[model samples]
Target: MSSVPITKHGAGLLKEELQRLKTKERPAVINAIAEARAHGDLSENADYDAAKERQGFIEGRIADLEGKLGAALIIDPTTLDADGRVVFAATVDLEDLESGEKVTYQIVGTDEADIKHAKVSVTSPIARAIIGKAAGDVVEVQAPSGGREYEILEVRYV
Candidate 1:
């Protein structure tokens, strides 16, 4: 499997979730399953079935998180020095050429992509178009609406 690119913050969040699942959720589900098993016939026990299903989901998520953490390549944006070029973990200020609206986005890993938080995935169309660009450069992005042009105003590491 290829290494997964993630910011330091994103990696930390994943690790924290993994820990919570293992230590807290895992134990709670185990106890729930045990209690459900005490409810008599296993065949018709709805609580047992639900607990087993929940356990499966939790265990699957735990495995997925472990695999991702093992393959993660965490990058700290504050430590990067790519001159003025836009790169992964770069926070870019842009001006929409058509609407004249200014917005900022931080290029992050897919797991951390949250448009509401101004974080975009590195694989996203807009991020791809601006990856190697510097300040004052105009980039054309193939957005869902259509082809849109944005002028780079500034690039910051954090």
Candidate 2:
């Protein structure tokens, strides 16, 4: 399997989730299933069914996190030396050409993309348009709303 690129922070978050699922969620679900089984007929027990379903979801999530972490190529944004160009994990400031609004975004892996937190996936249109470009460069993004133009104002590793 190919290695997936992930920011160091993103990898850490995934690791924490994996640990929680294994140590807390998995054991809790197991106990719930056992307690439900003790209550009586597994064929008609709603508690048993719900516990089993929850167990499946937890196990699936654990496997998915493990696979992703095993193949992750974690990159620390602070250690990057991309000559001021926007790259994975680089936080960038931009000015909207039409609206004249300024915004900041950190380009990150798909799993870490949270617009509410100002993080964008590397594959996103805005990130794609800005990657490899430096400050003062204008790039047009094909957004769902319409094509939007943005001028790169600054790029920071942190």
Candidate 3:
């Protein structure tokens, strides 16, 4: 797969999770499986079955995280030199043209996106529409409720 854009903080979070999984969760799961196997009967052992399932999930997640981290292109927003235009990791303040409501969002990767935290995925409609745009630019976004207009009010690298 192609390298995905990820903020420095996002990359750090992934690395921390990977470390925890490898150093803590992986060992715990292995111990659980071994203990379950020591219970004698493997045919009707729910504990053994459950432990094996958990082990599968843990291993799969570890591999997935490793792949993502390997293909990540980490960037620090503070070091960006976009000259005021919208780009990945840019925190933007926007005004709804129709409702006159204001909102802020940071363009981030899919793995780091949290709507409650105001972090939007780079592939999201709003992010796509505002990318390469500067303050005072109006953008039309295709929303489920229909097309909506938003005016860019401010942009911050952080």
Candidate 4:
């Protein structure tokens, strides 16, 4: 499998979730299953069935997170020296050519992409168009609403 690019913060969050799942959720589900089993008849035990289902979900999530962590290529934005060009993990400040609206976005991994936080995936249209561009360059993005133009105002490594 190809390496999955992830920001340092995203990798830390994944690791923390993996730890919580293994140490807390896994053990709690096991205990719940055991207690439900001790309640007697297994045929009409709704609690046992529910606990088992929850255990399945938790185990599945743990496996998924582990796989992602194993394949992750954590990159610290601060360590990169791309000069003024936009790159993965770079925070870019942009101004809309039409509306004059200014916004900032950090190009991150797909798993960490959150528009509410101004973090965009590296594979996103805007990111793809802006990558390798320097400040003062104008980029055209293929948005769902049609083509949009943005001027790169600044590039930040943090």
RMSD in Å for all candidates: 0.6, 0.6, 0.7, 0.8
> What TM-score does structure 2 among the candidates reach?
0.98
Residue 50 deviation, candidate 4, in Å?
1.3
Model 4, position 69: C-alpha lDDT score: 92
Please write out the lDDT profile of model 4 over residues 1-158, one tens digit for every residue: 88999999999999999999999999999999999999999889999999999999999999999999999999999999998899899999999999999999999999999999999999999999999999999999998889999999999999
- Model 2 per-residue lDDT tens digits across residues 1-158: 99888999999999999999999999999999999999988999999999999999999999999999999999999999999999999999999999999999999999999999999999999999999999999999999999999999999998
Q: Supply the global lDDT for candidate 2.
A: 0.96
Please, what is the whole-model Cα lDDT of each candidate in the order they appear?
0.96, 0.96, 0.96, 0.97
* Model 1 spans > 4 angstroms off: none
The TM-score of predicted model 1 comes to 0.98
Instruction: Report the lDDT tens digits of candidate 1 across residue range 1-158.
Output: 99999999999999999999999999999999999999989999999999999999999999999999999999999999999999999999999999999999999999989999999999999999999999999999998989999999999998
Per-residue lDDT value at 76 in model 2: 99
Give the residue spans of candidate 2 off by over 4 A. none
Q: List candidate 3 stretches off by more than 4 Å.
A: none
Tell me the TM-score of each prediction against the true structure.
0.98, 0.98, 0.98, 0.97
Q: After superposition, how far is residue 61 of candidate 2 from its true place, in Å?
A: 0.2
Which of candidates 3 and 4 is the stronger one according to lDDT?
A: 4
Weakest 10 consecutive residues of candidate 4 by summed lDDT? 79-88
CA shift of 11, model 3, Å = 1.0
